[model samples]
Target: MKLFFRLAKYLTPYNNYVIGAAISMLIFSLCNIAMIPLIARLSEAIAQKSIFQLNLVVAMAVGIYFLRGAATYGQGYLISFASQRMLFDLRTQLFEHLNKLSFDFFQKWRTGDLISRSTNDIDNIQNGISSTVIQLLPNMLTLLGAICYLFYLNWKLSLLTLMIIPLLSLIINKFGKEMHKVSSDAQKKTSDISSILQEKVAGVQVVKSFAMEKHEIKKFKEESEKSFWLSLKQVQINVTQTPLLAFIQVLGMVAIIWYGGYQVVTGKLNPADLIAFFAGIALIADPVSRLGDTNAIVQRSLASAERIFEIIDLEPTVQDAVNAHDIEIKGEVRFNSVSFKYQEELPLVLEKVDLKANPGEIVALVGRSGAGKTTLVNLIPRFYDATEGEILIDNIPIRDSKLHSLRSQMGIVSQETILFSGTIKENIAYGKIGSSDEEIKQAAIAANAHNFIIELEDGYETVVGERGASLSGGQKQRVAIARALLRNPRILILDEATSALDTESERLVQEAMDKLMQGRTTFVIAHRLSTVQHADKIIVLDRGKIVEQGKHDELLSKSGIYKMLYEMQFKEPA
Candidate 1:
């Protein structure tokens, strides 16, 4: 009930439509009650064999039904319009909230699960809302009106009929609890199925290469079978409740008829009033049955709402401070005893990492995998805040600056380049949206990408397939560089950008990278020793700590860890 009300708050903004729907429903219910008196009059007219009275009652019934039909149409249309608008706002709000979350939030959640929450779970909520408002509310109103009419006909019989209310309530409450638990489990299983589909689809090439197609299909079927059983269980619960409630209502109706007939024969109730009383009972029966179905829908919706609110209620671990403001950077970066761990239970990925890079200097990081090279660069962008210590850019604490302001002044080109599905021109301009064509072309030229882009069949307008599948490895790298060049940041991070390219492609990309590094504070995470040989400073890391730092030649002369790494990489064949 509390969750239902929480979901109802979304309807506040569309209250006018809700009010319209409510008024129409009220009229519809009133019309239903009005029919009871007409049923009494029709019975009296038939017993008297009065033709004129019968004709009048028949005409009034047609008029009342016409008005009821109009009310039904208005309620359906208005409520549907309001509900759809609410869904639109809710979906948009969820998407925007997702954008505000920190990097760790994405790391902690599965892509498929998040997708399910945004799409399938929200759809469930929609169904719940529509069912609660459209079916449940009207049925409840009709039931209430019918009960009042039944009491007006004979208070004693109405009281007797009401005896079953407690039993019905108990049944609804018991089955509703079961439905909620089953629905929650079903939603989770659905998320698991979505996760498997997303993971397998995204890694189709790997699966095919490993000849694991049969294995993946088997896994998918196992999940599907679980989902199928859960769905069947929910149906079993729903179907069981409907029949049980219907049987109880049928028992009540039988008692009402037997007692009401006794009253008629004893002259305690008129034939017309007895007829009207049965009509009222019939009206309430249908509403009660439909309400049972609505209960199941509401329970399922609440389950979905719980999952959605779990995400909506999360406070981002990283957000702009109250006084944080934007600042233009000049590329002077300082790391003062900075340390970080992904989570409280995890070991530190970076520790006591004090470093400085003056404007226009190139600092290269070299280490084995898992040595914290990427973690060090990631810190500069504030992807994750340091667990301890402070980082400064342009002499200002980065925590005091807005995230967009700090990151906008930096560019990153990684070994695995990511390009969205879009035109070459659009992808290049993505670094700086609304950029003029001339600016995009200039950036591409600077990155050595303009020639290849033009040589393509559609020139700049050619759509790059998903993740730039249509482009070659070197082509994608150059396009990524062009995007960075367009941003024209004061600070740059290049994570072995040319490592995957062939010799000729590497030379072209390296030349473009050199141009990108000029007059910018650059951090390079290198695998090949030859690439970073000319760096202004070389930092060697081991186990999350900087073991050595100096100019490349100076570190080589010292014969420390840097020299050892250099010797190992450039060593001759044994």
Candidate 2:
């Protein structure tokens, strides 16, 4: 109950519409109930051929029908307006919160699962709020009002009606709890099925290469069957809810007929009033039964609300500290005795590692995988805070500075090139928003990407596909480089940026890189040692420790880890 109210607050800004809808429906309910006695009197008047003309009664009936129609329309419009507004705000808030979550959150959740919550779950809630929730209010209110009017006409009949209606709520409340559990499970199963389907579609190439089509089909069939049964069970239970409520409604009518028939024989009730009472009760019963049937829709929406709230409630893993100052970087980075682990109680990725990146210098980290080269560079701009020790920019600890200002001074290009669906110019300008077109062109030229851009029919206006799949590996890498160059930051990070390219592509990329790195402080992580041979200093890492650091020739002359690695590579037969 509280959860329902909590979710309802999303629509509070549209309270005026909600109130209007309720008022209109209330008027409609009263009008429908009022017609009972009037219809009864009209029947008597017709039979008796009284002094009163028939035209007055017929006009009132016509007027009541018109007013009821108008009120129902008002109710529908107001409820729909409020529900749509609520849905828009809910989706917008959820999306905005997702943006605030750290990268780790996205690393753990699937694309398909998030899509389900944003689209499917929201749809369920919209229907619940607009139709089911509002419809329930009118149905219940009309029932109460009709019962009260029935008793006012005659208490003996009304008492029987009151007894019958409580059973409906009791049965619904009892089964509805179990129904919610089943419905929630069914929704989760549906999401699982969606995930499996999404994966198969996305990885059709892998399935074909491995010849696992038969296995995938069998797995999906099994999952689909499980979902099918749960849905069937839910619907079966839902089908029973209304008939049982209808049975109770019939009992009330039976009680009224028996008691009212006795009153007519005893001269305690008039025939016209008895007829009016039955008409009003019958009108109220149908919406009541349908409202009970709407239980399934309401329960399903509650399930969706829980899932959406789970994401919206998650506290961000990373946020700026209070009173944090803007980062004042002069391109001097120092990692002082820094130790880091992704999780507590786990061994450190970098153990008390220390290094300094001076202004206008390129520092290269070279090692085998798991040597923590990438992790070491990641700590410089505080992508993740060190578990121990301190990372400082311009000699001030990173934790004391605002994260946005700290990250603003550095640019990173990873091994994977991610270009969204946009034109080349828009993609480049994303590095520094509002960057001029001339600046964008110059950045592309500096990265050696301008010639390839102009080669396409649209040049800078060419729309890149998702993850830049439309472009060659070299082309995507250069576009990424061009994006970074457009930023013109105080610090730059190249995390194996040229690792995936062929020799020719690597040559072109390295040449473009040399132009970009003329004066900026840079950190380069590479497995191919030749790419970083001209670096001002090369630091060779082994098991998270800096084993060696010097110029290429100097390190080779030491006969240490760096010397051994280079010598072994040359001696190996191709």
Candidate 3:
């Protein structure tokens, strides 16, 4: 109910359309009810051989239907227009809200589930409100109008017909509860299926490499079958609901025919009146049966609405403070008494870590995997805040700085290069939007990527596939470096940026890295000991704690953790 109210607020701007639809629906219902008397008049005219009366009745019926058609068109058009606009606005808000969420939120929610909430769940609400609810109003009005006319024709018969309504309502209530539960389960299963497909499709290369295509197909089949069964259960409820309601209506109709016919035979009622009353009773039956189906749709939509609001209601753990201000940085960064754990129950990934990199200095972090090298650098950009203590830029805590301004001053290039599907020029110019062609070319040349980019058939216009899959490992890394360089950030982070390259490719990328690092506060996380040999200072970490700190040569002379790691990498292989 809360979510429904929230969603309804989106309709405020288009209330006029809703109003138009409601008015049209009412007019349409009145036109339909006007047919009952015309039908009654036609029956009387036929019995009396009154051709002129019959012609007048036929003309009146035609005019009533014509107005009904016009009203129906107005109702359909206005409601559909309003519903589509609401869908657009709601989807836009959902996507924008998603972008504001923190990394932890993405970690907790599966991509498939999020996609389902954004797409399928939203679609469910649209269909339920626009199609089901729009039609439901008219069906209910028609049912009411029919009941009133039945009572006018014969009070006793109408009272008997309405007696069955309470029983039908009870049945509808029971089926509605069961249907909502089944529909919610089915939607979850649908999300699970989406998750499997998203995961498998993104990792198709691994599946093919491991020859696990059959295994993946089997897993998908199992999930799909579960979704199918859940849908089947919902279908069973839907199929059962309409027939059960119809059966109840049929019982009422049976009593009406037996009593109304006896009244006509006993000369207690005229044939035309009896026929008109029967017509109204028949009119009530279809809409009443349809109401049961619409209730199920409403239930399913409510279930979907719950799923969508769950994400919208979440507050991001990482957000700029209300008083946060933009600051101009000078490439100096400090981490003081910093500690971090992904979650409180987990062991700290960084423990009381203290570090500093002054303007135009190169600090290299050399550590084994899982030693918190990436985690340590991640705090500088506020990807995750320190669990204890604080990080500062030029003596001011980063927490006091606006997020966009703070992040805009730094650039990162990780081991796994991520480039969206777009032209090479677009990808290179991504960091600096509205960058001219010359600026893009300059950035590419600085990264040593221009030569190969121009050599391609489309030159800078060549389209990179998803994740830059069309490009080689070295090419993708250089492109990523170009993107970072284009931003012209004061601070830079290179996390094993060239670890995946061959000897020749590494030399080219290293040359580009040297160019990018000049005049910037650079933090390098490297597996290859040779790359960090010229660093101003080297920090060695082991199990989330700094074990050694000095120049690369000084660390080697110490013969400690750094020396052991250097020896392991450079040792003679027999």
Best by lDDT: 1
* Winner of 1 and 3 under lDDT: 1
Return the clash pairs for model 2, or none: none
lDDT of 1 by residue, 153-213 (tens): 8999999899999999999999999999999999999999999999998899999999999
CA lDDT of each prediction against the hidden true structure: 0.92, 0.85, 0.90
lDDT tens readout by residue for model 3, 1-574? 6756877788889999989998999988888788888889999999999999999998998889899999999999998898889888988888998998988899989999999999999999997886464788888888898888878888998899989999999999999899889989999999999999899999998999999999999999999999999999998999998888888888888988999999999999988998888778767777888878888888898899888878888988899999999999898889899999999899999998989889989999989999999999988988888899899999989999999999999999999999999999999998899999999999999999999999999999999999898999999999999999999999999999989899999999999999999999999999998999999989998899998999977888997999999999999998
Candidate 2 off by > 4 Å: 50-53, 572-574
TM-score of each: 0.97, 0.94, 0.96
Cα deviation of 159, candidate 2, in Å: 1.2
Q: Write the per-residue lDDT of candidate 2 for residues 1-574, one digit (tens) a residue.
A: 8779988898899999989998898988888887887888787988889746477788888999899899899999998998898999999999999987876688778767787888888998987786575687777777778878888888878777777657777988876886788888887887888788888887898999999999999999999999999999898888877678778778777877888899999999988888888887787777777766677788888898898999999977777788799966788888899888877877888988888889989999988789999989888777777888998888888888988898887888889888988898899998899998899999999999999999999999999876676789899888988998998888999999998999989988888888878788999998787788899989999888888898999998897888777776667686
Off by more than 4 A, model 1: none
TM-score, predicted candidate 2 vs. hidden true structure: 0.94
Off by over 4 Å in 3: none
